[model samples]
Target: MAAKDLSTMYGLSESDPEQKLINRAGMSASDLEQIDRIMAEMGRMRQIERRIMRSSQEFMKLNETDMRALRKIISAKHAGRSVTPGELSQYLGISSASVTKMIDRLEAHGHVLRTKHPTDRRSQCVEVTEETHLAARDQVGRHHAKRFEAASRLSSEERDVVIKFLAGTSDAMESSLGSPLDDDAR
Candidate 1:
């Protein structure tokens, strides 16, 4: 389709300063409404995830920040990556000193362990203990696994488009807000 036709499909027009480029280019109101509905569903999913996380937090007897830190560790391990205090600090967008205190708290609670970095003598990596790891998996893994299963139901072409769209939206939001992951830290 021509760019003009494409623009008209999305409800863009000259009067919308916020969407000037899109306007200049014609978005149909119906397309805009559809986008809004998709975004609303995404928000609903986020709410459900938060509820699941809250349940896990209560079970672990930890506050939001602590749970978030643990999640970062879990996510890193899942990705075959070792997370350092410094990296955690970056993830949390906090000072290294604050990260140390959080790490200390987790260690004191037997949820985490500190060890020498395999290749870096001067640095250390944090790991979640096996018991804690299992607990975390039990807490939130089901929802994640279900989501994975849902993804498996998609055709490759559909998955590729969805992956690209998700990445594009995330990147666009980060670009607009000048923050990576938005309020994901907490």
Candidate 2:
């Protein structure tokens, strides 16, 4: 079908900067509304994530990086892989000294353990304490697993569209920044 001509009645208010761009691009008010709705939903998701991060930090008496490291360790453990301080430093994008300090803090809090690497004598492996492992499984892990239910409810075609949209949005942001954001971190 031929696209509708919307050169004349683009609906944004005069004070809105997007008003002229919408008209020039021949976009309809409905298209703008849908974009606005998508942005609003993304904003809400970000807010929820921030809340969860803050809550997790406060409850665990740890900072954001500490929580992140713990999660990384937990994930590696679950995958039957060992995490080393050097790897943590690389993964966290920080210096080895900073990684050492963070590991010290976590160890002091009984959240993690430092052990000799089974095969590498020169390297040490980091592991979350059982207490920490169970707490994380019960808290952040449980919270994240709930998302699977939402995905499972979607039809395969719907899921594909959602995936495409998310990837496109990510690509757009990365392009605008002239670099991929955390390509390895994810």
Candidate 3:
């Protein structure tokens, strides 16, 4: 596999400190092969994600965090709710100061807006702009449409298999991490 592909698949870069450690760990050859296949498929999925994010960044001049913030705000607005900086901090697993900087950058770029909260004048609500929503529909949403089409084309049995596999994988990951997957932790 290409170096970048390996890195993306295993969440490692060129200077992985744990590579040697993992290599010497006791495991059967069959077990190693299974792990290899799983990483390869995960790498393929990362490529698909790269396509979507790159298109969104090119269209909106935003980074991954900015794109995520916009998506979250849009979701909240659609749900008739508002997002605050503290909530975003908790959701994104970042510090409040970092969230402030993010909010400032997005607001300056006209991607998000900060307005007074209805109940508390001292607090603010963050929301995605209409222009960003339109841009998302044109870029990232188009990518999702293609993926949905691909999924739809799968046979019922194939889809069921995929669903079960994904669900089991998600559960395994959560158990390994000792934490539940938060809805806003994407």
Candidate lDDT values, in order: 0.79, 0.81, 0.80
Candidate 3, residue 98: how far the Cα is off, in Å: 1.5
> For candidate 2, lDDT tens digit of each residue in 1-186?
344423222224433565454443776768876666566567667778899878878888999889889988998898999999999998888999999999999999999999999899999999999998888777687778877888998999999999999988888778989966762445
Q: On a 0 to 100 scale, what is the lDDT of residue 85 in model 1? A: 94
**Residue 180 of model 2: what lDDT?**
62
Off by over 4 Å in 3: 1-41, 155-157
- Expressed as tens digits, the lDDT of each residue in 70-153 for candidate 1 is 888888889998989998898778899998998899999999999899899999999999988999889878788999998999
Error of 2 at 108 (Å): 0.7
Question: How many pairs collide in each candidate, listed in order?
Answer: 11, 0, 0
Sorting all predicted structures by lDDT, with the top scorer first, yields 2, 3, 1
Question: Whole-model lDDT for model 2 versus the true structure?
Answer: 0.81
Tell me which of candidates 2 and 3 scores higher on lDDT.
Answer: 2
lDDT of 3 by residue, 19-102 (tens): 763563686767765666667677788787888788779879988877877778888888999999988988888899999999
TM-score each candidate.
Answer: 0.71, 0.86, 0.72
lDDT of 1 at 163: 96
Q: How accurate locally is residue 115 in candidate 2, as Cα lDDT from 0 to 100?
A: 96
